[model samples]
Target: MGIMEILMIIIPTTLLWAAPLIFTALGGTFSERSGVVNIGLEGLMVIGAFTAIVFNLTFVDVFGAWTPWVSLLAAMAVGALFSLIHAVASITFRANQTVSGVAINLLAAGVALFLVKYIYGKGQTDIIQRGFSKIDIPILSDIPIIGPLFFSNTYYTSFVAIFFAVVAWYVIYKTKFGLRLRAVGEHPMAADTMGINVTKMRYYGVLISGALGGIGGGVYAQAISSDFGHATISGQGFMALAAMIFGKWHPLGAMGAAIFFGFAQSLSIIGSSLPFLENIPNVYLLIAPYVLTIIALTGFIGRADAPKASGVPYIKGSR
Candidate 1:
């Protein structure tokens, strides 16, 4: 394929793949920034993917093209509802956040698989016909080189994600609430002395992570898999978490990192389709992303000093 043709497909596909990661990674940023370590993002994503597919299949004929939007709402709601378990365990009950998050992941996996088997009578849900469509900017799409690489054939959700990345950056850096959130993460006792409710902020952070993470998985199902299966969200949430760490927990940085991973994934998939690359083993490309995740995490561990109190439950008297 020519450069333009490859760009036309790869760019849009990368953006499509990146959307869910962007949202989920940003959600992780919120969670970790507020002293709650959420490893249950994987579970939240599966819940979202399943709920979105179910909503899409149930409402496709009635809602038509609006099914994707409705599914997004369903995903967010389900994600938040499910995350209540994690919230209660970590924030209220003072359980180990890592253990709690692991529990959530296992529970979500079992539940999602059971539903797929019992309700669908198979391993997967029916495919969705209604999904988000690409939007082409009239003037920008006509430009050469950068046009197809950036503007042309862009999904609406991609732009929405870009907007959210900017908004997230502003909200985290520019808002008073952000200050309180950081305070809660840094020193809960100090924040409490300052009249900030650390508990409430933690809850909000986890809940927001859940909701956004749900949207991330839902968007992925709509675009990439076009269906919900037990495997639909497998490893994706973890990948997003890796992206968050890879980006040093910054919103825009995480967005860029997630998009980079998306491009890597897209390139791998496309490589097998190309004439020359068809000879290479697909297994190598398939494992590249995870391998990169490991390298990033290990290499940056020293530099990525998470929030001071992350994963630590705050106690009134213990401190």
Candidate 2:
């Protein structure tokens, strides 16, 4: 393909890959902003991916094209319910947040694999026949360079992810709920003194993390993996966490960071097909995203400011 053709291919692929990251990073934002450290995003994503794939396989015919979207809802619901474990352990019982999150990750992996073996008698679930396919936006896709690069032959989920990023930014910074959520994270005692239920805000934050993280997993399975297996989720959740921190925990910043990482991932996948990158070794390409993640965390952790009370369990009536 020519240069223009290559750009067209790479740009949309990057966005498609970035969609899941955006969703998961946004989930992290919600949780951390509300004084919760949700390291279990990975587990929630696995559950979401497994649940969505199972639902899609079971109800593909009945729901037709709507099956994937409905399956997304199923993922979100299960994700939220599973996140309650983390919430209760961290918020209700005041257990160590990191330990609770780690436990969640281990539990999700075990449960998903157990269900897979029980249901399929194998290590992986059956693939769905139909998934979210590429769609060219009407009128917009016809625009000259921008249209061909972005609007044409793109996954609808990518646009939805972008839209939600904007919505997340608005909800996190512009609304009353956002103010209270931030307050609870920064100074829960002060928030409680003002009659804001710190526990409730923290719960909402963690639940939002689960819901969005699940949706991210669902989208990834449908758009890329098309099946659920032990390796289906892999390290994308951690990558999302990295993106959240790299972006300074802001929604739009996370979106940008996700897109950058997604581009790196896409490069790894497509490097062999490109003219200049074709000469680079495949191994380096494969490890690029993870290496970038390490660099980003190490380079930015000192400068990036987390929520003041993140990972700190709240104690009522303790001044």
Candidate 3:
């Protein structure tokens, strides 16, 4: 293919792969910014994927073209509800936050698998008839080089993901709730003294994470996989966590990191098609994204600092 054609293909594919990561990483940003260590993002994503596939399969006939979108809502609701287990354990009962998150991951996987078997009598669900499709933006897709590379043949979810990243940045840095969320995460005792309701803020943070994470999973299922399976999520959630840390807990930063990772992921799948990369071994291509993730997390981008009170449960009057 010519360079322009290749660019068009690669850029759109990267966005497709990046959209879910953006959502998940943004979710991580919210949870971490509020001082809760959300190790269960992977589990939350699995729950989302499963719920989305099942709902889409069941309702595609009823909802028609809107099935996938409606399924995302179902995933979001279920994800939020499932995350309450973590919130109650970590915030209400003062359990170790890490342990609570891990439990959520384990519980979500087991519950999802069990429900899948019980509902389908099989390991994976059948593909839905109405998954997301790429669309060329009306006038924008016709605007020369930039249009073809960015707007042509793009999933709507990709734009939504980018839009939400900007919204996330504003919500975290410019809003009153954002200020209180940061305050609670940085110093729960101080926030509590200021009548910030530290517990309530943390709960809100975790719930938001769950909702976004669920959307991430749903997007992956409907736009990429078209079905749910044991490997549906794979390690996308951990990769998103890596993006959050690599971005230094900033929303726009995480979105940029996710796009980078998405590019790496797209290369792994499309490398053989490119003349320069075709000579490289397939194993290296497959492992590039993971290697890059480790590099990003291991100080390749300088020191990344977590919130001061992150992972620490707050007792009402404790010092």
Candidate 4:
């Protein structure tokens, strides 16, 4: 393929793959920013995926093309509710945050599998009748090089993800709530003394994480997988966590990391078709994103420090 042709194919595909990661990584950013380590992001994603698929399948006829979009909202609600399990266990009871997060991952997977079997009498749900579709931006797609590379044949969800990332950045850096949230995460005792209601802020952080993570899962199912299955979510959530850490827990940074990972994933899926990549082993391509994730987390890409109080449970008056 010519260079332009290759660019056309790769850019759109990268956006498609990045959308879910952006959402999930942003979720992780929120939770971690509030002194909670959300190891259960994977579980939360699974719940969102399962819920989105089920909701889509059930209402496709009634809602028509809007089913997938509406299903995402449902996933958000379910994800937030499910995340309460971790919030209560870790925050309310002062349990080990990591253990609680792990429990959430396990519980979400088990519950989703059981419910799938019960609901469909099978290992996965039937594929949805309708899912997201690519479209060309009205005026933008008419531009020369930039148009086709960025605007043509793109999923609306991708744009939405980018928009949300910008919003996340604004919310985290330019808002009063953001300051309080950071205060609680960095030094809960001090924030509490300032009358910030450390517990309430933490809850808000986790809840936002859950809701955004749910949207990530729902986007993956509707725009990528088109169904709910045991393997549907797989390690996307973990990859998102990696993105968050890689991005140093900043929303825009997470979005950039997600896009990079998405590029790696897209190469894996489409490498064989490209002349340059055709000679590489398939295993290498498949493992590239994961390997990069490990490398990023291990500090090879510069140090990424988490919030000082992150993963530390806060007791009202305890030092």
**Maximum-lDDT candidate:** 4
| Candidate 1 off by > 4 Å | 135-139, 274-285, 298-302
Residue pairs with colliding backbones in model 2 are none
lDDT of 2 by residue, 1-319 (tens): 7988999889989999999999999999999999999999999999889989999999999999999999999999999999999999999999999999999999999999999999999999887998888999999999888999899989999999999999999999999999999999999999999999999999999999999999999999999999999999999998898889888889998999899988888988988889899888878855666676566667653567888999999999887
The most accurate candidate by TM-score is 4
CA lDDT scores, all candidates in order:
0.86, 0.92, 0.90, 0.93
Count clashing residue pairs in model 4: 0
After the best TM-score superposition of candidate 4, give how far the Cα of residue 57 lies from its true spot, in angstroms: 0.6
Candidate 3 lDDT tens digits, 1-319: 7899889889999999999999999998999988999999999999999999999999888999889899999998998888888889988898998989889888988998899999999998998899889999889999988899999999999999999999999999999999999999999999998889999999999999999999999999999999898889988988888788878899999999899888888888898898778888878755665676567667775767889999998898778
lDDT of 4 at 32: 97
Tell me the number of clashing residue pairs for each predicted model: 0, 0, 0, 0
State residue 163's C-alpha deviation in candidate 3, in Å. Answer: 0.4
Global local distance difference test of model 3: 0.90
- Tens digits of lDDT, candidate 1, 84-159: 8998999999999999999999999899889889888998788778877777878888888787789887887887
In Å, residue 239's CA in model 2 sits off its true spot by 0.5
Please report the TM-score between candidate 3 and the true structure: 0.96
| TM-score, per-candidate, Cα-based | 0.92, 0.96, 0.96, 0.97
How big is the positional error of residue 161 in model 1, measured in Å on the Cα after superposition?
A: 1.4
lDDT of 3 at 80: 87
